[model samples]
Target: MAALLEYLPLILFFAVYKFVDIYWATGVLIVTSSIQLGYHHFAHGKIATRHWIFFAIALVLGGLTILFQDEQFIKWKATVIYAVLAVSLIISRYIFKKNLVEKALIGVLKSANEKGDTDAPLNIELPKHICEQLNLMWVAILAFIAGLNIYIAYNFSLDFWVNFKVFGLMGITFVAILITMAKIYKYLPEDQS
Candidate 1:
């Protein structure tokens, strides 16, 4: 549900492109992204940082595409967003001495604890090496995605690029998540009694 909502703009863009054209599709992307953001804020009481970033990117790049009557801006949007995220994650890990993945995992554990899940594997702190490795993994993944987007956009037809953006990227991301979970599974705390 949330995953589908996150991809609503891209899905709408692809569908609109089929019915109309790139410019009109870009317009629909911007509108749908805005609506998705609004819905998140309304439901969650506060928008997540990533949601805000994506919404801003969609609006700005989509608007540029529509304004200039060029699809290039929209085509580069994914690469730009991924690059920004990769850089931000790297900086957060190195400069700020924070691992975003670890923080998020800890938050989930805390939430579970609060919900009275007594058996939850609540680590007081994620191991530093694990945090660093996970952060680097994410950086590598995002960089790969950014490069992949550029490669596809430049080498493939617009139709192929649109399909890749909607389906290929999502499939890649899902696989990456599964791999990450498998790698970290051993690190999770085991019940002791």
Candidate 2:
């Protein structure tokens, strides 16, 4: 349910774009994203940081697209979001000394353990350097995605870009998440417990 809600905006945007046009799609994106944000706030009592970032940018870029009667503004939204995420990851890892990937892995491990799951690995900590390497991998992945978006949006047709944005990028993102999880298994010591 939550996952569906999270993707509702993108799914609807793609459908609307297919039926009508970019301008209408941009409007739909903004409206649906705003609704998603509101749903998060209403249900959770607060919106997540990523939700805020996405909504704010989508609203601004979508607005620009409508106002200027140009699809280029909306085309850049995904790239901008990815760039912001990459920069934020770099800043958090360096300035704040926080590795979000490590934290996410730890949290998942913790939850699995707490659930009394036999498959859950022991709370063995990953080495700091290995964690840093993992974080850098994510940063690189995001930067690559951002660059890819720009390249495709400019070179390809808007319809192609829309399909890539909605389905292709989503597939890539899911694979990235799975890859991150796979890293924990690869780098961490086998839980002999």
Candidate 3:
């Protein structure tokens, strides 16, 4: 159920794209994301601010694309969102001593802190300096993904873009998460008990 919710936007967007227009697809995604956000807030006592912001941007860009009747606007939507996220991550590291990724990483670190031994610490606690360095890497990867989207969209067709939006992104993100988890595993303490 929770897993489905995470993928709902992409699924809704893809379905609408297949049956309707791109703008309609985007609109449906916005609506579904709003509902999902509201549900999370009321039921889980949490709000997905990042997703909400991205959805808002998608809505505006989708509307603009439809209004101008130019597919380029819609294509550029991914680029704009990715660039904004990357820049924000980089800035947060420098100005706030922590970025979005570090905050999220902390959640995992805290759990590891409570459970794992200190035989070989990954220092998942992550100092400010390390967070800054990580933010740089994160921003670069994000930009790379955005650039890949642009390259594919320009050279290929809409179908390819939509498929990449789901399968390609999901696959790549899964791999990245796995890599992170593996690294944590390596640094895990020897005490299994």
Candidate 4:
């Protein structure tokens, strides 16, 4: 798909680096992600919030890796980013009483409602309590997945790490989205039909 192609450079770098040096691959990743971030910011009017955070963390970790020549820094980057996001999600749910994931998802529903689509708004609605519960569910899921990533990266090789970074993350996220969709679908208002 076109979306996949847009990330080809990153994918290819990961593929070609199996026998190549890690620094080269790391450099390419940093450069490519930075460029991609710039492209999004200039064309899309705003950098995606989560991705921007990911890139910033990657940038910092990449710099540390280069400076110290320690692969551990690069390896732990995944752990740190995942932990930060997981903690943020958990804190938002428990402390702030917010569901950031749901808010992002609801933007689509809100947009449909704003567009005066009678049927669209009905497709997604929930009691406030269910919304909060679902949000907490997502936070738990994210934390679990983050911990899983740490396990894989620490025990596995670089090739596996790269593959997991691409395919594994995508696969897990797709599964999560499906689960979320199933939960939301049941709660759709009868009027939406």
lDDT per residue (tens digit) for residues 28-146 in model 3: 87788778888789887887678678778877877787778777777877778878888888777767766877687777776666666554544444456555556676788788888
Worst 10 residues of 1 by lDDT: 184-193
For candidate 2, lDDT tens digit of each residue in 1-193? Answer: 9889988989899999999999998999999998998898899899999998899999999999999999999999999999998898899988998998788778877766666646755657788877887789889988999999999999999989999999889988889888766666765445422
Q: Candidate 3 — what's its lDDT?
A: 0.75
Taking all chains together, the TM-score of candidate 1 against the true structure is 0.87
lDDT of 3 at 125: 41
Per-residue lDDT over 1-193 for candidate 1, one digit per residue giving the tens place of the 0 to 100 score: 8778877888888999999999999999888888988898898998888888888888898888988898999999999998998999889888998888888767865775666647655566557887778788889999999999999999999999998998988888889788777766676666411
**C-alpha TM-scores of all predictions:** 0.87, 0.88, 0.79, 0.78
**For model 4, what is the C-alpha lDDT against the true structure?**
0.72
Best by lDDT: 2
lDDT of prediction 2: 0.87
Task: State in Å the error of residue 9, model 2.
Answer: 0.8
Stretches of candidate 2 off by over 4 Å are 109-124, 186-193
lDDT per residue as tens, model 4, 1-193:
4376356545855765675766777777778778777777777788887768777876887778778877666776666766787788778877897877777667855665566646443356566776776677766777777788778878998778878877887788789888777777766555432
The predicted structure with the larger TM-score, 3 or 4, is 3
